[model samples]
Target: MENKIAFIRQHGIRVRIHALLVDRYLQTYYDKLGWFSDPYEVFRDIVNDPDKHYIFKSILAKTNVSKFDLPNKEAYQDFFGVNPVSSFKQLSSHCSWTGGCLLEKLERAISYDLPGLLSSVSKAAATPAPAKAAPSPPPPLPGTCEGPGCEEKPKNRWRKQ
Candidate 1:
């Protein structure tokens, strides 16, 4: 709100905006906010803010980020697509459901205090995780010899002959 008034005051750009037409005025500034008129960019920006993490964090933890780090709008659309990013309200009367919520509150970020959330989400945004090492064989049985060059005898066969 302050930004809109400041920009208007600074540049001397005239707008016939009023209580009802504010949405129209806001739409003009959408590109400047960095969506690049592309939903993929919007998704990218919203996911990284940590505040908006709730909107997509579950998907991040469960799936490879690469599955979503699409290169363009077409690819993003073809992937697990979403509802219109445009219609997502900055403040909604009914926010607890999908495709509706408080944009500012959502993007303001509450995960900074959570190491698991920060590490998983932010690091994944930056790069893929390193591969894990294979597990070592289980410790030898109680009666079996342990350590290098030690081999256990075979159990009795053929009813001890």
Candidate 2:
């Protein structure tokens, strides 16, 4: 649990820094409004703008896909090999306001399948482990080792030490 928290903290810092760098680059090249925009600006915009908020949520849903969708692990690897955010941004550029109908399709698909997907995941996770078989009885104690009045040595006598 501590390891997971530490990882999340480190990952969050990297994401924050990357977002800052991207914001700085865009402002320098596109906006030229230095100090006026920062990493928090986009976040603030997402909070303030209802449409942008939903767009961001839709993109998040798209990346967290169903595990069953891919045939092989390689296919899963290839699917996530490309950055979904970059793809969404590029695809969304086709429409300035809401990216034409892509956002709608994405939201619709998630809404349609998320419940069943979540339910299946929950069911699989909740399934109990198989019961183990009872252990075989121990061999009759040495010396008392049974074989119709046999005379096997005691176990302690067999120890090399």
Candidate 3:
């Protein structure tokens, strides 16, 4: 019974780490696109894309679970009832939960249990804030008429010839 409890705890930690890594990977991927209006929509699009999905699966397969104190893929699959690919996708689906996103949970876990991972992710995603671009010159200052065809005319005044 003690061994079973230990195994469960170990498995939970591994699952949490795996979820963290997946969230980091997805955030980096979406960040490269400049802007994503809705993170959930982008996530769904990425998950639906066969090529992208395969790449994500490959990342999971290549990542060293042992470093996170988890068993190898085959063993994990045998014990968890699902392969790493399926497990990753399932966890990622929970990232959009209303209570608290999986990434937020992962962040808290890392902050408490694995500060190094949290620091690494923060450094990796720390992009310089894009320059402000001069606030776009504040439009045209009402209706001053600056365009090519914009002619200056008196207010409500008509020409009589």
The lDDT of each candidate is: 0.40, 0.43, 0.51
Error of 2 at 115 (Å): 13
* Ranking of predictions according to lDDT: 3, 2, 1
Report the Cα lDDT for residue 5, model 1: 37
Strongest candidate by lDDT: 3
lDDT of 3 by residue, 30-138 (tens): 5544463665555445544525545345544755344435334444324333332333443456655467676557445544554554455566668677777665566
- Candidate 3 Cα misplacement greater than 4 A, ranges: 34-98, 101-161
lDDT, model 1, position 32: 36
**lDDT for position 56 in model 2:** 30
What ranges in model 2 sit over 4 Å off? 1-20, 33-126, 140-161
All candidates' TM-scores?
Answer: 0.21, 0.23, 0.29
Query: Which portions of model 1 miss their true places by more than 4 Å?
Result: 1-71, 75-101, 116-143, 151-161
- Scored against the true structure, residue 14 in model 2 reaches a CA lDDT of 40
Cα lDDT tens digits, model 1, 68-115, are 332332433333245454554333344676665543232333213233
lDDT of 3: 0.51
